[model samples]
Target: MAAAAAELLSDEGYRADGRRPDELRKVRARMGVFAQADGSAYLEQGNTKVLAVVYGPHETRGPRSKALPDRALVNCQCSTAAFSSGERRRRPHGDRPASELALHLKQTFEAAILTHLFPRSQIDIYVQILQADGGNYCACVNAATLAVMDAGIAMRDYVCASTAGLAEDTPLADLSSPEEAAGGPRLVLALLPAAGQIALVQLSARLHQERLETALEAAGRACRALHAVLDRVVRERLREVAALLGD
Candidate 1:
């Protein structure tokens, strides 16, 4: 495979993958793929694969030290399988990167969820990276959207996210790991695309203000594209349920 970061090869403006700066990678998602969890989803964007599970709306368990007085407390844990990448990881969770990602995910979901509606409750979201090609944050957000929808959790809007990488003065959409490592500025934006509201924005490196708007816009557009793919998955799931009921 070509390095997504290398350079803009063609003058016509195409990246290593032949996608235009503003074009997103292909996305596919499925809800309720796991039967045990209250809700589960599998999502794939390009070569990255992720699974998200929502296990509660139930009372808080474990130690009471972290319980909250108002609204449900949202707990998030992110883990990547040792074999999720070409290079294996020794430990799964509690690693510095995983812990930071968990916190970010918790914050992002808290923004989308109607937590006020479920006072004194709890929601646990666990995300596992089945394959870590790149843009893990965006993939997690998209997968979590499906899982939350499967759990019937009330939300203001779908939380969609996508990665943007700056290339030759243009912001390219949906970066893979190679592009990310190429040293260009990259931004991960999680948004309630339907409402045009940003839930989270994280930058991998510094980018100039003059180009920030275009990059943000590109990220938002990629997120909207993600939302459409997720919507289709949800609809297909409902149709499957309807068919089962008929049988």
Candidate 2:
């Protein structure tokens, strides 16, 4: 596996996709994709595609016991469609991986959102994977950020995320499916770029302490790059909405 991954980078330092070690896959995003939801967004990073929808800063449903007196309850659900990946999944939700991803999303957004302002209210965020390549968590974070922004919810800062891996002692940014399958140590980071704060960090596989800092720095750089792209998307959508309103 190491030998195969080592071959992934050419002598010219480009990966099989012709991207430099530090290069990220192209990011395309759109806001307000769903009219019925309070807010919605779609994002594509390379071949991975995700859609996110936000609903409510409204009264809690099902159980009033879940409501908080000092802050809004943030609930998140993340699921991949049966055909989202190369191998079809049997179930859509209620699986272990989906449950774990949903929990992570909840924790990530709770940190970025100004929950204190909406005491006794509930906010629901739902994200679905339409396609899967790699870096699903990062893509979900980016999509959720846009959806929340469109909902006009108060947030301290945008949450940007990216994945990094180490191959042959070289740090690689924004890993693709092939790279992820190569079995290298991987790190996922979700950041508040403006405040230089990290909302969440998860590591898969063992990484030596000596190389941890370098890998983390690479992930941070990729996250900041994603933030730039997401900012542009938001601004463009706002401009379009303004024009339509004026008309």
Candidate 3:
């Protein structure tokens, strides 16, 4: 498999889609896109489509067993649609991967949001993957960021995420599934770009010491790029909101 993937690497160091090693898939995002939710956003990166919704700063309604005294509780459920992938999936939650992803997402948002601001409350963030290309984690984070912002939630910084993979000993940023499947180490990073802090880092496969640094650098650059796109979307959303207010 490694040899097969190695063969897929291009002579010019570009992916099959012609993206340079450090380029991200084109991203499109919108905030307050759903009328039903308190906050919602639809985000697209390449062929991956994800929608995130934030439902509350309301009091916890479930079993009191889950309530926290000093801070808001963050409940996150990450589910993919049945037809989200090339093949159909049977269940939305309770599946092992979905359960794990739910926990990870809960952790990621908890770190970014100021939970203390709304004590004894609950914030529910539900993310549904309408399509799966590559970089699903990054897409979820990016979409959720917009949803949180739309909800007028306070946060310390915008958390942007991106993936990096080592191809032909070169670090490639924002890898597509083909590149990811082409084999080598893959690294996913959730970062606070403005603060230059990493909130999460996950590595798969193996990579050398020197290669990891280069990969981290590439991931950082990809995250910064994602940040710019997100910022533009947020600004556009505020403009629309302002116009509606006629001010």
Which candidate should be chosen as best, given TM-score against the real structure?
2
| TM-score for candidate 1, residues paired by index | 0.94
Instruction: Give the clashing residue pairs of candidate 2, or none.
Output: none
Give the root-mean-square deviation of each candidate in angstroms.
Answer: 2.5, 1.0, 1.5
Q: For candidate 2, report its TM-score.
A: 0.97
Q: After TM-score superposition, what is the CA distance of residue 119 in candidate 1 from its true location, in Å? A: 0.9
Give the candidate order by descending lDDT: 2, 3, 1
Runs in model 1 with CA error above 4 Å? 1-6
Instruction: Put down candidate 1 lDDT per residue, 1-247, tens digits, no spaces.
Output: 1333346435677777878878888888889899999999999999999999998899988777666777889999999988888886778767888898889999999999999888878999999999998899889989998999899899999999998877756778899777777777788899998789899998876667877877888898898888888888989999998999999
Cα lDDT of model 3 by residue, 1-247, tens digit: 4574455467766678888778888999989889999999999999899999999988898898778888899999888888888876778667887787778788888889999999889999999989988898889999999999999988879989999987666778888877777767889999888888787888986677898898999999999999999999999999999999996
Could you tell me the lDDT of residue 94 within candidate 3? Answer: 73
Model 3 error, position 80 (Å): 0.8
* Model 3: CA > 4 A from native: 1-5
Candidate 2 regions with alpha-carbon error over 4 angstroms? 1-4
The candidate 2 region of ten consecutive residues with least summed lDDT is 1-10
Alpha-carbon deviation at 230 in model 1, angstroms = 0.9
**TM-score order of candidates, best first?**
2, 3, 1
- What is the TM-score of each predicted model, taking all chains together? 0.94, 0.97, 0.95
